[model samples]
Target: MDATESTPILLREDLPGGIARLTLNAPGSLNALSDAMLAALAAEFGRLAGAPETRVVILRGAGRAFCAGHDLREMQAARAAPDGGRAAFADLFARCAAVMQAIPALPQPVIAEVHGIATAAGCQLVASCDMALAAGDARFGVNGVNIGLFCSTPMVALTRVVPRKAAFEMLTTGSFIDADRAAGLGLINRAVAPGRLEAETLALARQVADKLSGAVRIGKRLFYDQAQMGLAAAYDHAGAAMVENMLWRDTDEGICAFLEKRAPDWPR
Candidate 1:
């Protein structure tokens, strides 16, 4: 099989400065996370995880909405299966969770550029990223409760980024919140005008990409590793990373450059 077969459900674009943009391409379905799309995402993210040149990743959806969540039509079709879709649903959620976990596990940082509406699993995608930038008018919610499905999967990522009360309200009430409110709740990093969304997102990605790739990678790894540890353990883990980083040749050059009032000659 050709390892690089192109899929219509997803698009990958390489930009300068080691920045990559992954676009969800099924706008007609509101960029829903169908099985095929999830597979495509997993494939691309897997490829990127080992790409030493990629320093940052920006995720966005084509057309109006960022994503409307899972493809209900696809799920409904699986109801005729031997087990009444139980097996299918289980596999779907498992694959989706793997893709979500892959974001933070990647050596590079991932940023979500969102607009229109990001609901249910879609909102979970935003929360899974290292950071998110959304259009001022974009709406977000984990509204599976309205359809009796209950967004239990989405709650995993949502509760991690936002406060418990805020996450519970959105999950239970199936209510949508504006981008500004999402930002204030810590679900998104910032909210900009619709016309400026792409530009602002690229600008942020470029800023991150401009940093020393080695330092950034180490920092990203340490950030997530320490986040789940107790205070003492976290400090111990972070201290080791700091000591290792300080001994790197690039770090020495950076410090010398700073004292000499000149730019560090970092590798591209």
Candidate 2:
């Protein structure tokens, strides 16, 4: 249902051990990236960026589908604006891109809990996350081309995660891939049974949250930063990161604990 003043566009739940769950709440629209939804996401992501206590984030949608992409009605309505909605369209896309970029920029690793369908920009959302776990029955696609609105923005994230040829085929054909196929394409970590999707995602979130938060934060930043560099540069950047990481007191304690055959007594 469309979100009324009494309903939230997005919902956040903080679990024990610093795991934060953000649910896209516009199920009536399949969590479409409407202007209000985009604004809510940006605001929540901004808040999370400063929340050092949040070690991991899991983004999911309420209702049957994860997301159905942009709201067609909202986009069509923008055409009523002066300038033929060109400026509005541009601003909308820019804001959406910011939210997508914020995923990797976050200190906490973000995991997408996907079910049902994630298409067009929704698929981009999945690809932008650090990792994803989808239900076996879930479907993914960048199908804007079928409507004459090529998913160029979504393509940016899609191409980075999946192979070039595969991305191109999906974009051109506007075909959806099942979760197993998506996992094989490296789009998601794995596909779990529909009944187990929530439990599996929460378990993975807790597993990551259980790690040393400082190390995970540093490593997450370096991982994305080094991915864009030349091999030699990447190696140099990674080596420097390792040096910085090794100097942490927790690292020293962890190493000592391993040698002593004891559980790591890392500071919380």
Candidate 3:
């Protein structure tokens, strides 16, 4: 697909190495999640959910920044509403939550390939991914407080991904952390040199691709399920997952290949 010719919100394409890339394409505003952009993202993420060749997925910005958050100008207009009609803002927030949830719910892992500044909703995108890798010195934060607006949707992922105080600090202060610090705070998976960001990310993406496809999909699904359960329920849930996986044909094929001293052909 000529992703460049697609809507100025998001673009999708199959890259080599069984990877899919979803580029946030509103370069003029650091790829901020406009309403149209968020809607497009939901659709493309749905497509990736069913793609057999999509072993892993990457989310990145087109130009200078990953995403600056929801379009503040939209908020400004909402705030300027006559007679305090700001319910539109709630709709906007809900849509942002849906878009963010879609990332983590993907059957295959999603990687945030952040390069430049990622603030507010952009930083939430980083927190919501299965893994986040950034170019060294890249900046990130839920920088809404400084503007007297709250990063509500961002807080959901941020609180889940980072420690409590650390997550709140970013929200309360709206200050940015450099890549290394972001990783240390558990917001980013790792930091690589800017020149080598794509190579490093693709290498990691390829590593994900080399795994059994069915296991990756099923395992990722179960992983999320288990995360939300109580500790005792988690064991019971994993037990069910184990039973389900044990009967799968891939397991039988995997064991057979192991005994035969050859790599098994994993089925998707």
Candidate 4:
């Protein structure tokens, strides 16, 4: 086993079939993001991003809740620190969002394997992922509004995942959306039975992994790049990307295989 398998932090990992399974390990804290947890998570993700053995990443939490968002105690403590000079709270939240964004920006596909409750920033993490899968019984939402705190940070990612009105409904109501409803809203990609969460999530991740790694990476990169462009420019951007994709060795092999009526052998 790798050393991470024995660590107690916000995330742990197991390398299997080129898939990096990152577990949100702080069950007692509901996988809350403490300074340590955040640092550990960033470090682990960084490692996986550069690791040749990593082709895909699966994110899930231990126990019930995926993540309870930030550890309030740590938040309060940071506010009390000497560096708490000004906007310390804001600064911390900014850092958190930055790290969260990095996960999806990585070349490999990221799948959020969610179960139980995912609330506040925890729900934000789910929305930020490339794809999300939740157990049919899973519940998700940004509940910060319930405590008089706006889920402003989460809104950045959540807005992109669901309709404006739908996102705002959860924000205003601080109510949970069921997994199936989440999928309908585009917040989750799939919803399986609670008992089948793990197997189902892994199955999806493997489906992605089984495809051409290079192609998936290029597609993922172009997806984010194209998403930010204006509609008219997006088509142009896609065309340019398509040209680049066609120039790749795998693309040529893929087309050749199709024409020849045989399965294509992909390169690593």
Candidate 5:
């Protein structure tokens, strides 16, 4: 099926080697995360969680800007509702947060292929991913504070990936950092020329996809699980995961292949 044609708010393409690219499809609004857009993304992530064929996911935007954040017009319209938009705003943020959390929960790794500007909730989306690769000209910020709406939701993911002081500074100042600066702050893995952004992101995705899927799944789960634990507990959990991984047939084959000086014949 043509995934891109199947959805008006989001585009999906299954590339070679089990890499799935999901592009935010609203280019005219700079790919703002409208309510429909968030719903589409959440649904796609739900499907991919069970899709065994999908080994990695690449998230990109369709327009000049990666994402400019929430649809202000939509949000403003909600204010006319009887409850003064409180319930609507609550639901919107809750759904958006679930979608962000879903990225790391998926079995496959997710890479944010970012270019142009990624601000507010857009920046939150980038931080939610397992990895991010941005074009050299890209910019990132969680600048909701500038408009009187502090980026509380984005802060959850941003502070986890970036240092406390740096994250605090960005949150308070509503200032943007260039791609290179984002990389330095651990928000992205690397920044490359705009022309090479897709190629570089694909290469990185392919590298992860080349690994044994079961092992990768286990590792990905453990990586996040251990992060929230104490050092001793983290080690204990990771040790068990390592033991389980070593028991897999693929692990044995890989070890034997290494000793024999040949590539492992992994199952396709």
Candidate 6:
């Protein structure tokens, strides 16, 4: 269904070659991550975890921008409660963190199709993805410091993806980085002309979808698992993963096909 129809806050569209596109549709608030939007994303990612047919997922925002950040109005309204929104704020950030962590946890690779802007928690969302492609005019920042609040939550993912110095500069200065700058910072894979963003993103997604799904899934998991370990332990973990992957019939077929110069007839 289209964004205007079912689930206006979030829309899911499936395409050929197992690519699923999720659009954040709340353009009026610049696609802010409202409570409902976060819930929608969590539930959708839950479904995707069990959906083996979906090889890749593309997340984008509709209308003017990718996402501005949290819904400040919603957050402010919570302050009317007796506790001054402390409990509400805590829950909101916890939920947002869960949604961010779910991206790398999903079996399918996620590509952020960013345009216009991705700031604060929005920038964190891009960092959480396996990869990202932004429009040349797209912008990124963790500018919560500009309003007296530090972007501590977004900093978690930001620091992991970009260098510590670069992340610190953006976090402290509350400045925006252009798409090309973001690419250099390693927050995104690359930037393309605004008109070509979608095409280029889909091309990358399709290229990934063409790989052996089982191997890619293993590699994705291995990539993340090894990152948090000591060097020796990381190699041990990756070696075990390699052992499991090498036993897959498709992996054998891929190797044999390469030697024989024939297309692999991988089992479905």
RMSD of each: 2.7, 0.8, 2.4, 2.8, 2.3, 1.7
* Model 3 bad stretches (over 4 Å): 1-7, 83-85
Worst 10 residues of 2 by lDDT: 1-10
Candidate 4 error regions (>4 Å): 1-6, 81-86
Instruction: Estimate, for each residue in 1-268, the C-alpha lDDT of model 3 and write its tens digit.
Output: 2124445568777887789988888888788788778888988988887878789998888888888888877767776777454688878888888888888788889999999999988888889999989999799988888989788878989999899998888889888889999999898889999999988988888899888888888888888899999999999989998898889888888989999999988853
**Positional deviation of residue 244's Cα in model 1 after best superposition, in angstroms:** 0.4
- Judging by lDDT against the true structure, name the best candidate: 2
lDDT of 2: 0.95
- Summarize candidate 6's per-residue lDDT along 157-265 as a digit string, tens digits: 9999999999999999999999999999999999999999999999999999999998889889989999999999999999888898889888899999999999998
- Which regions of candidate 2 deviate over 4 angstroms? none
TM-score for all predictions? 0.97, 0.98, 0.93, 0.92, 0.97, 0.97
Relative to the true structure, candidate 4 reaches a TM of 0.92
Tell me the lDDT of candidate 4: 0.85
Task: Give one digit per residue, the lDDT tens place, for model 2 in 1-268.
Answer: 7677898989999999999999999999999999999999999999999999999999999898999999999899889987888998999999999999999999999999999999999999999999999999999999999999999999999999999999999999999999999999999999999999999999999999988899999999999999999999999999998999899899999999999999898865
Model 1 agreement with the true structure over 105-140: per-residue lDDT tens digits: 999999999999999999999999999999999999
Highest-TM-score candidate: 2
Clashing pairs for predicted structure model 6, backbone only: none
- Inter-residue clash pairs, candidate 2: 1-28
Which sections of candidate 5 miss by over 4 Å?
1-7
Backbone clash pairs for candidate 5 read: none
Question: In model 6, which runs have C-alpha deviations exceeding 4 angstroms?
Answer: 1-7
Residue 262, candidate 2: alpha-carbon lDDT? 93
Candidates' lDDT values, in order?
Answer: 0.94, 0.95, 0.85, 0.85, 0.93, 0.94
